[model samples]
Target: MAQLAVFDLDGTLVDTPRAIIETFSAAFGSLGVEVPDAPEIRATIGLPLQRAFGDLLGVAPDDELATRGVRQYQIHYKELILPRAQELLFPGVAEGLAGLQDRGVTLAVATSKFHASADALLSAAGLRDRFALVVGADQVTHPKPHPESGQLVLDTLGIPAEHAVMVGDTTHDLKMANAAGLRSIAVTYGIHSAAELATAEPTWTVDTFDEVVARLDKALTTQDQGSAV
Candidate 1:
């Protein structure tokens, strides 16, 4: 069976913590609220914008406020944060992705970011054409940890959960993978610490993108050998 590798965009593939922090800070400043520290903003990286903003601001974000915040963030992001796309691509990310693609493994992105923004970032990072499928938060009725995004990607790729693995940097990714009955691998270099990801009980945890590729190669090799036997 053909293997499928689905990735999370923000912390997993791209190190967007700095951009996100600055954007959120600008957004909150516009709203007359003090911005939190980078670590606090980074912790909410994988969640949807509204929830992330709410968590950072320490209040329940109504639709209007959330929408405004997102807009403000986008404005700031385009002006100041977007130019850092080059810096956002983590080390070994491009090589790892190219290695997977070369192996004929289907690649896809399932992210909580908006589709257009995700596309722009991927394009800027030179990974836009790498993924055969891309599913953003706005494309699904339910977002991460809900399984819908992963399910949609699988359905779009015409692949089954058994032949796929979800790679992300957060417990939210593991939760969604578990919900979809797919194996998950968490990366230690993302926003979440190893201890936090351990709570989600991913199938594997690795320190780098190259380590992720190594683990997947091992898993696939073992499965191939087992089938031959």
Candidate 2:
């Protein structure tokens, strides 16, 4: 059986606070509202735009203001993110992904970003071809912390939960992995701190892109040896 590694985008493979934070602030500013603090905005990184916007606006996700905020955010994101997509990738990410793919791990993306937006960014980053599958929040009934996106990715790719691991940088990602029955690896070099990630009880916590590769490599070796036995 093949091993699968599911990843999140913004705070995981991509160190993307600039586009995200600025777009969020732009959204609030356009609506004549005070923007949330950067840290508060950062805390919502892994959630769907509606949820994040809702929280920041102090309204329900479907409320008119939140909807407007999301629309405004989308506009800002395209302007801020698309032109410099590759530059947003975290250090060692390209190499780490190359190494993982070479080792025969099936890769996929499960992110809160909408499908069209996610694909556009990854393609612009020259990374769209790396994954066999990419499941965005727009493709699922619920986003991270709900397991819908992760389960959709796993089911679509015919990879069982046990044969896959979810790698991300937020509590939402780890909690989603837990719900989906996939072991979780929380990368601390992104949005959340190590201590914050611990609250989600990830199977393992790593601090760098290199550590993620090492852990997956070790997991595959263990799985291989167990099969041999």
Candidate 3:
């Protein structure tokens, strides 16, 4: 059986912080509200859209304003993401994914992005077929830092938590991996700084996609020998 690797989309596989921050700013602008600071908006990248917008707008997630913000952000982002999808992929991602698959690693994506949006970008990137499954916020009842999405991916792929690793750039991703009983690989080149990611205490930390692939190669080889994560 192949080991499973679960990845977060934004900040992990895709360098989307700039786009996301812009989308958030534009959404608030459309509502005639001051945009939240860029860093503050970036900090919400791993959250569900409604929650992210609500946090930035200082409203309840279920409030009409927050709901409207989600709609607006989606409109702007969907329009902006397609043409830029392949460019947004962090360098070496496609190669790293291929390497992992060659070594019998099954891949899956778990992201805070809505299902259709995630599909669009992955398809545009020509990387959709690499993943055995993709679980977006809309595809699960609960999102990151909660483990529901991670568990759903595991369940759907029939992979046990112990045989999987979750790679992500945010605390939400690491925390979800931890809660889901999977090894966590924290990547620092994304939106969150290494210092911030350290607080989550990932099983392995990588600074680039090359490092990620090398680290995984070592880890999986060792795991195949019945030791290490």
Candidate 4:
């Protein structure tokens, strides 16, 4: 049986915070609202756009203004953000992904970004076709930290939670992975620091994608050897 490797897109595989922030700022500028500072924008990295926008704009969510904000953000994101593929994939990311794929592991992406935007980024980063499944915020009713997205990926990949592992860069990812009963591995190169990620109590915390690959390789090897016993 193949193991499932799920990933978060924005901060994990691709460093898209700058593009996201600039696009959101442009969106707010269009709406005549004050643009949030970089730190404020980065803090909401893993949330759905409505929640992120509401938090950053200091407006109540589920309101008419938040609705408009979501709409405007989408427009600005497509126009301003989608074109900028400035964020490079973290070191060893492509190599690690390829290595996992070569080992017959099923890989997927579960992110809070909209499906279209996620696709665009992955494509731009040369990672779009590598994934077996892609679950986006728009694809699920409940986004991450809720486990719905992870569950959706597992269902799509026809894998059980025990055979799956989630690799991400935030407590949100760790929470979702834990909620879904999958082992979560946190990467330190993203928005959250190691200390913040520690709060999520991830199965492992890695500083680089290479370390992630190494840990995953060890886990897979152990599982294989155990099954043979």
lDDT of 3 by residue, 1-229 (tens): 5688899999899888898888788888888998888889988888999999888888899999999999999888877767898999999999999889888889899999898999888999889999999999988888898989999998998989978888999999999999999888999999788889889888888889998887777766456322323
Deviation of model 3 at 198, angstroms: 1.2
Top model number, TM-score: 3
Identify the runs in model 3 with alpha carbons over 4 angstroms from their true place: 224-229
Q: What is residue 70's positional error in candidate 4, in angstroms?
A: 2.5
lDDT of 1 by residue, 110-164 (tens): 9988888889889888899999988888899889989999999988888899888
Tens digits of per-residue lDDT, candidate 2, 1-229, equal 8899999998898878767898898888999989889989987888899988988888999999999998998898899888888988998889889888998999999999998889999998989899999888888887889988889988899989988988999999999999999888899888889899999999888888888888888766466322100
lDDT of each: 0.84, 0.87, 0.87, 0.83
- The global Cα lDDT (0 to 1) of model 3 is 0.87
Candidates in order, TM-scores: namely 0.92, 0.94, 0.94, 0.91
By TM-score, how accurate is candidate 4?
Answer: 0.91
In candidate 4, list every pair of residues with a backbone clash. none
Model 4 misplacement above 4 A: 224-229
Clashes per candidate (backbone, < 3 Å): 0, 0, 0, 0
Q: Candidate 4: minimum summed lDDT over ten consecutive residues — where?
A: 220-229
List the pairs of residues colliding in candidate 2: none
